[model samples]
Target: MAKYNKVVLAYSGGLDTSIIIPWLKENYGCEVICVAGNVGQDAELDGLEERALKTGASKLYIEDIQDEFVNDFVFPTLKAGAKYENYLLGTSFARPPIAKRIVEIAKKEGADAICHGCTGKGNDQVRFELTIKALAPEMPIIAPWRTWELKSRDEEIDYAIAHDVPIKITRETNYSKDMNLWHLSHEGLDLEDPANEPQYAKEGFLEMGVAPEQAPDKPTYITLSFEKGIPVALDGEKMDGVTMIKTLNKLGGENGIGLLDIVENRLVGMKSRGVYETPGGTILYHAHEVLETICLDKMTQHYKQKLALEFADLVYNGQWYTPLREAMSAFVDKTQETVTGEVKLKLYKGNIINAGVTSPYTLYDEEVATFGEDEVYNQADSAGFINLFGLPIKVKALLDQKREQK
Candidate 1:
């Protein structure tokens, strides 16, 4: 019931946001400023400004954040090797930065409140509000789905049609989606039924990429070079983060790679099925793993795997602002000190094969590891090492022999 003279909304020009602008204006009598963040959704952003204006938004702001999306958000999570229950945290990683930009725009525009089209039954509501609360504690968050009378996507469509909001969606193809440079996620519709097998070939609903079976027969080889855990080049061609993502996406998608379908547990106590397309991210995850194998010691690699699971959970649950996440980031960064290397991958029909990997600081010493004679490693030394390593086993065997005699 808080009064607001103006509100800035995180608008995507989708059906939900299209209706939200007029609803906010009519219900709260506040001027609405729509802000759209472009984090490599490609042509989905075309004509967004005019669309927002037609939907009754007084002002519209669209910002290009592709590089920042990859560098500040995606790479950090990638370096940490975070994945949410075997699925990469693609959509989860992009939310915090988008919400941060929403707060920044709200403050600049002198708005008392910020809004989003996220529903009450989703994780995005928590992600958006948490970012707002962390960045600007006093700024009020107006979540229409939680408070409004509008119930379903069908009702929202009706409202948009009645208001002449220029919506491109219809009831037949109603699947909630979120897209970024890393991945595209599809939810709702037939996917909600767990028994239903997802149709990846469907043109209008699923993201336009390749299916594994439909991918090219010939494998495409790619090499990713990294510096201090950040990807710096592709196949000896130096490129920025945005360009690197674009290049890899093309390579990975061509091979029909990076499609994930799962029933995920939402933070709001609901189980939802989502199909994700993360072509570039799939390549990066595999390439990074290949590099880590050469650079990280056995214990560091094992312990970092444990941290990655926790990090993924925190991000998925919208705990991006917590101290534990920062501490974990520090630990992840430390392990990446020698993660500088090139990982060669062979992409073929949805499989990313680790072709070759090399690092300047690699712990893999070929000379000492050779089965043949090597000056650095003496064969006789293995006898002493085996005795020390098997001390506990030897003691247990002796105790068992003594017990049998008793």
Candidate 2:
């Protein structure tokens, strides 16, 4: 009656997943191998190994992938200027690398199936399952939410208590949260009702930063440099992906730079309301856009803008490992060839203000564009150019005049 001899479960020491360990063993009669990927969840990862094994997991694998996450996934998504409904693709894109590692560990541990704690109503279930399907199609997926008898979080709590499984969440104060290096998203509870304003003043409401009103009075200024659209340095100091993001997180969080409260359309044919705190990501996105204005050609910039919409959708829909995403990334990489520049920005109370930008690839020429009479440009040439440019409009107007006379 057991479907899998061993299952590799994508384990986070959270309420839902904690109980899932016991549920899987009871229902499936299989050994559960827990794998927790570290994508910069900070305090969320503390004592996860002990918790996994303590709660019926045969073994636990804690993999450090923060550097790879920022360098490979976050930077590329940033370069594409991809935003899922004007918010950073933080949680959306973070799932792929996590899922990728789960497949790897599953193979290493000879797991016949991969499992996750994602609920049926949530997008994450699709994200994790789709990526698993892409990488290792034969490996079965065990989504407990879709199959289990636990109807609600309250039910889950009751089950956990019955099974003697330890968890931090309580029915009264449970708010669903997903955290990574780029962002921390808060949902469920009061957020379910769109009318209820998010309690920003509350301790757990925002994990990354303070409220905009509570930010310091003085604005913070910093310069960021990019090479091939990837952020390379912060404030004139060169840093690797992890350090740059970490440094920006502290600076941007202090200034309350990135926060968005949105009710977004989920792929599961539902609308979900959540507050996302993406301090560092917001800063990086602003800086990248500013640099792109100078570095990229007008046509390429316009096309890429359109492409960014598709890119954002793909990432949001868990198509990160698909051929379309790969092709789009190639196009994005080619466009970034000239996207090397320095952008200065002012961060003040949740606002990212552009101070200045300079790039070797800037197409703007002072000699040609200056209002002060330029020797390099002949002003009289514009008369003929405008006449030719407006010829179609002029002909159309004449035709309309003749029709009116008739």
Q: In lDDT terms, which candidate is top? A: 2
Q: Tens digits of per-residue lDDT for model 2 on 209-291?
A: 88899899999999999999998999899999998998999999999888999999999998999889999999999999999
TM-score of 2: 0.97
- lDDT of every model, 2 decimals: 0.88, 0.91
Model 2 scores worst on lDDT over the 10 consecutive residues at: 199-208
Runs of candidate 2 exceeding 4 Å displacement: none
TM-score for each model: 0.95, 0.97
Number of the top TM-score candidate: 2
- All-Cα superposition RMSD per candidate: 1.8, 1.3
> What total of clashing residue pairs does each candidate reach?
0, 0
